[model samples]
Target: MTMILGFPLAPIRGVIKLGELLQEQVERELRDPAAVRRRLEEIEQARAAGRISAEEEAEAVNRVLRGMQT
Candidate 1:
């Protein structure tokens, strides 16, 4: 019966749905201006603290800006 076949796939379906939800949340946050600003600030702080190099900071900032565009 279909139930027998579907039972094994139920967990897979749930995992897929969870992944979709997480993706949606990430996209929503990326579109948030404040969230983007905070990320940029974090990158700057890291650079100032020497936790990241200037090149790394630039790359991180570019990535955050690109995420905003998307």
Candidate 2:
């Protein structure tokens, strides 16, 4: 059995692999302009619906827009 520091390594490796895959998918979605726009809209809708505070909405908007720039 694979081991690392006396702990099984297989489960650890699987967790790491899953994290990497999740990061890749998130990055891919963030790179898309439409995804950014959709997020912005969602943020605004949340604000309008009183689900999010103005500051929260602004921060989310800024983050989404910033991601689009990169």
lDDT of each: 0.95, 0.85
> Across residues 1-70, which tens digit of lDDT does each residue of candidate 1 receive?
9999899999999999999999999999998999998999999999999999989999999999999888
In model 2, which range of ten residues has the least summed lDDT? 1-10
What's model 1's TM-score? 0.74
* Candidate 2 per-residue C-alpha lDDT over 8-49 given as tens digits, one digit per residue, 9 for 90 to 100: 666887999999999989888988878887888899899999
Name the best candidate (by lDDT).
1
Whole-structure CA lDDT of model 1: 0.95
Off by over 4 Å in 1: 1-8
**lDDT of the structure predicted as candidate 2:** 0.85
